[model samples]
Structure formats: C-alpha cells, structure tokens
Target: MNDLRSWRVPLPQTAVKCAATVVLAALAVLSTGDPQLVFLAGIAALGAGALALRDLLAPVRLTADAEGLTVVSGYAGKRRVPWPDVTAVRVDERQRLLMRTRLLEIETRDDLHLLSTFDLGEDVRDVEAELLRLSARD
Candidate 1:
C-alpha cells in the first residue's frame, strides 16, 4: 500500500449477504401466497437489494488516499473526510457468539465510523495499520 496513491476496498462478503437476504425474501414471497408475507418480502428484497446494488455496481466500500478517506453513504453517494479531520484510527475487538469480532474505528472531529471485516474485506488491524501509515504521511 506504500506506493499506491489510493485504495478502494470492496465489501464482497457483505454484498453476498445482502444478495442472500434478497433471495431468501423472494423465496418466502413465493412459498407463501399470503398478501402480508408477499408485501413484507417485497420490501425486504427491494431494500436489501438496492443497498447491495450500490456496492456491486461500484464495488467499493471504502476509499483512502493522500488527501482523505471516502466511504459509501446514502443510496449511491459518498462521504468524504479530510485527513486533518481524522482524530484517531484504531481496531476494536469484542466477544460475540462464542467468537471474536474486530472492527476498525475511524474517529473524526465529529463522528465515529466503525467498519467490520465484512465491510472492509480485510483484517481490521491491517487496515488500521495502513491507515495509521497514511495519516503519518499526512
């Protein structure tokens, strides 16, 4: 990552989960002809599919560069954070369901963004280290 001017990390596993949600919801709609079930499933499929579509279409969950970090926001928009605004970058780990979960925490002047392995498709520690390096260069 040293020579790279920018890094765009994709959420492949999260996209797969979203796609699975859509498929499962659609199956539920088909299996049960109930109007309520159909309506609920339709909502689920559309909502989940639309979000995942943004990732699948652009294939980017997060982006980092010399200037700042960019992350997916809204339906198809991006939120940018300048390097100066970033206050801290760290990896947080916790126990969940008999396993450990790790996430990268990006603290800005006014906000805190936590990204999981599913969201980054990379180990949080590695991402944090890379981010720290970039910030140091800044």
Candidate 2:
C-alpha cells in the first residue's frame, strides 16, 4: 500500500514581480497627463498585476497516491507522474525540489511562488518521503 501526503512550494519571486509591476504601473499613472489614457493604463496594469499576484500567491499542491504523484500549481497547470517512472528526486542548491522522471523534469522552485512573501513554507521532505515510500512499494 502507498500512503499519501501533500506539499506546497514557497513563493517569493512571484510576490516581488507582482509588487514591481504594480509600482511601475503607479509610476506610469503619475507621469502621464492624459486622464483617459492614464485611467485605462492604470486599470489594465493594476488588474493584470493583481491577477499575477493571485497566481503567485496561489498554492502549488503536491499529492502523492499509490500509483504516482500529482502536482497542481494553482491555475497554471498540473503534473502527474507514476511512481515507477520516477528516476530521481533531489533538492537543488536553490532549495527547489528537482524531480526527474522517465519523461519529465518537475522543478518546484520555492522562490518562484508568492506564498513565501507571507512567510509560508512547504515541507518538500514530506513530499519526497511519500514519493520514496511509494516508489519502494512498487
């Protein structure tokens, strides 16, 4: 039997990018004189920035089951890998989870998401341990 566990990745880059976009947009608004153009740009930039932030702040969920592992990155996309196909699991120097499989490379970059800005951290070890346990079962 394979036990299951879940993990989320830390996000810092996302937040920083979102903040920079917002700040730049604000600056643009201040520098522009046309009310119509300024309003339109401001709305567009702010809206896009907010959406980007939402994506960054969203969770990157990792769920492991008997057959394989499923990684759902908010609305970005999802990755499912069978245990038997996984070739290696390692933590990179950047602290990202590097998962290599027969067909894919799953790089979980903790700093690329925005959750870390809020001091949120994920337990990659738990996910790695579950993957190990499942791989052994097979």
**lDDT over C-alpha atoms for residue 120 of model 1:** 72
| Candidate 1 lDDT for residue 44 | 75
For each candidate, what TM-score against the reference? 0.73, 0.48
Those runs of model 1 whose alpha carbons end farther than 4 Å from true positions after fitting are 5-22, 25-29
How does candidate 2 score on lDDT?
0.55
lDDT of each: 0.72, 0.55
Candidate 2: C-alpha RMSD to true structure equals 8.5
Q: What is the Cα-based TM-score of model 2?
A: 0.48
Off-target runs (Cα >4 Å) in candidate 2 are 9-21, 33-58, 72-75, 94-120
Task: Supply candidate 2's per-residue lDDT for 38.
Answer: 79
Error of 2 at 83 (Å): 0.7
Residue pair clashes in candidate 2: 11-113, 11-116
Model 2 scores worst on lDDT over the 10 consecutive residues at: 111-120
Candidate 1 per-residue lDDT over residues 27-118, each given as its tens digit: 76686758777777777777777757666665565678767888666555678998899898988899988999888888889887877776
Candidate 1 worst ten-residue window by lDDT: 1-10
